[model samples]
Target: MDRRRVIDLEEFADELRRDPHPVYARLRAQGPVHRVRLPGSDPDYATWLVVGYEEARAALADPRLAKDGHKIGATFLDEEMIGKHLLATDPPQHTRLRALVTRAFTMRRVERLRPRIQQITDDLLDEMLPRGRADLIEALAFPLPITVICELLGVPDMDRAEFRKMSTEVVAPTSSQSEYDAVVRLAEYLTGLIEDKRCSRPTDDLLSDLLRTTAEDGDRLSAQELRGMAYLLLIAGHETTVNLIGNGVHALLTHPDQLAALRADMSLLDGAVEEMLRYEGPVHSATFRYAAEPLEIAGTLIEQGDHLVVGLTASGRDGGRYDDPDRFDIRRDARGHLAFGHGIHFCLGAPLARLEGRTAVGTLLQRAPELALDGTPGEWLPGLLMRGMRSLPVRW
Candidate 1:
């Protein structure tokens, strides 16, 4: 890497994890795209980090930036550990996988899940509030989504602590060996779940539905594909919401005025959730997209086989997108934010995540009228991929 051309992002990792907007602003001031070396990556190699709003938005959907690493003669570790799931594939395959999954994961289906989501929220809060003080992430944020998704996937009760460990290793790994072990364990677990579903009578769950789902031309997800899909859905289904609730609540507690405004008018629930997604979304960047062919984005020439990340957090702070983008106002009309990303790979679990966020935040405030930060929020999750706390202590 040319010292003049490559920006060393590893130097900014600590600051980015603590508070990324300042770093994002600094990068954006220079330009939308930059050759940056991320933490744990080869110093000699660099990735194009897209930070500008318009550029990030367009880069997300641009087919030239292929989601399939294989197209560029490479593959992400998870894709190899699991298989070619939606985030790891381009059109044709993605189109097919999406269509089948969409049939089961419809908006109408999500709407029907509101009552159960609320019940889960109420139950979690009921158990948590009486304690007077609790780590919000452990007591609520993490459990709610995990419970909902586990039930949705018809996964039988298992060691959740173990599961979370594996999931974290895959997403925000501390070591390569640990990550590989986690992937192997998770892949094995998912494979078992698939086999169980395959042998057992069909159930009213996404996993079982995927097992029976077939296309007009008799195309069905093979066993390996089912395992991959299960791994994707199970992980993506809850992890995003876990951070959504954690990050959103932390934002609210930190900004008393916004928290007060939200309490005054519960009607702001919808807008507040949207604002949460915009202000401090769960993920900093969408999954890496590779340059399948040479292309230019925001005047930066990206050669074929180049790896890049679209900065969702950076885009949300772009002055070009929202006036006073860094402010934490719940009433801001934050539609079209790249929090859930843009285009085809936009989060499929977005509706579910939004619903859970709305229910979790609104219910928490209503129940714990005196809810406040018990202490400084714990350390943020390591790595730039996820933006959330390892713990957020709070009290009523």
Candidate 2:
């Protein structure tokens, strides 16, 4: 049998930074699973690309699959920087860590924040209205969710800017030695913060809840684990929502009819957000996973220890699944979309993300009815992991 062709990760990364759907279509046409060499890695390091909807979902749901980034020697940060966080663990361990925080991310907890989220959205827009022209990302998309997460996590108001900077550097598509250093620094800062929170009395916030939580055996998260969890939640919780709001707004502005329909009826808010997630999710690829044992997906065989990259963005747009998959329609039933991922590892923050998206986009439309893109939508962030514009200059 012929070995699957390698995808040029550098070229693919360039496409991802700009626009990747066309390239995704080409890869998807090849097969359900394609072998590819990741750029900046060893020549022998071949990873499986799961791009189709069914195959991506299957890979995510497969129990034999592992989310431990260390398994395949994939390290965005040094070993000291990782510290066995939920994103770096496989089942059993991942299950335990996730369960500890699941209640905090429940729909009820998210629903209770609707009023606060709306207030934050309104306040940000209030500040931007006078500017006439502002970068939606800086003024609204980025700060709104960061503020919300800080409030939810009980992070000190004064520390938010530092946290935001650290989070951005850690997750930016382009990472260098300095960026890895930033991750270490951020981890150290979070370790201190968690220690501080532990020493203080509990408060009415997620961090406080986490601090108070213990396993059935009376075991609580270690300092390292707590720091890791805090880092993951802070970054994932805010950054993804920022893109959802930013990307969703950009999508609407680019599609006038859809924007008009949404403005004409507020009931479409839920559907519109779903479409936004499906059309352009924050994470282009799901968090990296590895095959624990040999597995076969859609007739393609994957060996144990092989790296797997599930293309959430590509799978959402698979033509076989959605009619006119390229077109963005708020009316479409996008429930099956894998934007938040699938199975046991699906995003725990989906409710919060949706609430933020609706509050941000819905409020923007109501406030600036004549909102239009201020600059050419030519510049986008570069990365295979994330898909979003670097900045959205807009005017009322």
Candidate 3:
């Protein structure tokens, strides 16, 4: 096989699972986009790669691109497992579903939860402080987001632990047949939870609110749709935020001077969070999208039905866009980075994610000013879709 072909297939997947930047840098130098073979699939399967910042933003915003997996007839999920959730829908339907939950995600609502979020952070940290040494992820980063999300969504106390277990299997790189079984179980669990909420009076929680929402035409979500919505919210809500906290802390610890700068100046918290998103965002690539029709982006013609994987991590590190793209500089204006994505499909939980990130990292610095890594920084999660330290063991 040709060296390029081999690199594009097997080696690329390995490199991507570890750290894709070096490979992405090489590809970006060639052009804004490239056609790469999709690993672990049929020989004919290939995905269009969007690497440049401009191209990624454009592709994400393009209406001709469809995010619904059923539209193109290829999916990593079972047909029944694929719900008509906002994240997997297009156009007017997507708009409608998103609007239903928009109010709960507003900045005001997120701000109101600040104290609660801080309390959650402090509570988790309280447990970690006495350990002398603890995995930041398990002790703090992972639990805080899961707990906050469970509270926000009204996930039953009985199901919260199971939910976390299934979520891990679903996102794990080496997930197998058993993992798929766990996903099905999770779906079933959510189905029951939704039904329970439907029978009961509504509450202030997100799940209850979703149950109460009706479209302008008086249409309500079907049982399947509700389950799907719950799944998306539960998974995306906690998983990504866990990474944001973990990745942000790792970034700061790796750069002592920057950490000191943040410690000295409390005002830099917001910018530091933004820098974390740009430097090592949780979601390495946006969810997949397919072209509904032929389109031209960055001088590359993408045909109808063609799959496109927006290199979000690569785009954030584009030297063409930032002066020192790789540097973890909190002072840099990293606002335009495509970490949460762009356009109509921009991440709905962005405000909440930011809030969680700010509280988690800020509380950590204050509580453990002497914090340092307990393991080598290179021991990190292996995946192309998400980037995070696997075991962030730390000591104050």
Best of the candidates, TM-score: 1
Q: Provide the global lDDT of candidate 3 against the true structure.
A: 0.82
Summarize candidate 3's per-residue lDDT along 67-110 as a digit string, tens digits.
98778886766336646687788878888778766745567867
* Candidate 2 global TM-score: 0.95
Model 2 stretches with alpha carbons more than 4 Å out: 69-79, 159-162
* Preferred candidate (lDDT higher): 1 or 3: 1
**lDDT comparison, 1 vs 2, better candidate:** 1
Provide the lowest-lDDT 10-residue window in model 1. Answer: 1-10
Q: Order of candidates by TM-score, top first?
A: 1, 2, 3
List candidate 1 segments past 4 Å from native: 1-4
lDDT of 1: 0.89
Model 1: pairs clashing at backbone N, Cα or C within 3 Å? none
For candidate 3, the per-residue lDDT at 77 reads 67
**Candidates 1 and 3 compared by TM-score, better number:** 1
Top candidate on lDDT is 1
Score every model by TM-score. 0.98, 0.95, 0.94
By TM-score, how accurate is candidate 3? 0.94
**Worst 10-residue lDDT window, candidate 3:** 1-10
Shift of residue 276 alpha carbon in model 3, Å: 0.4
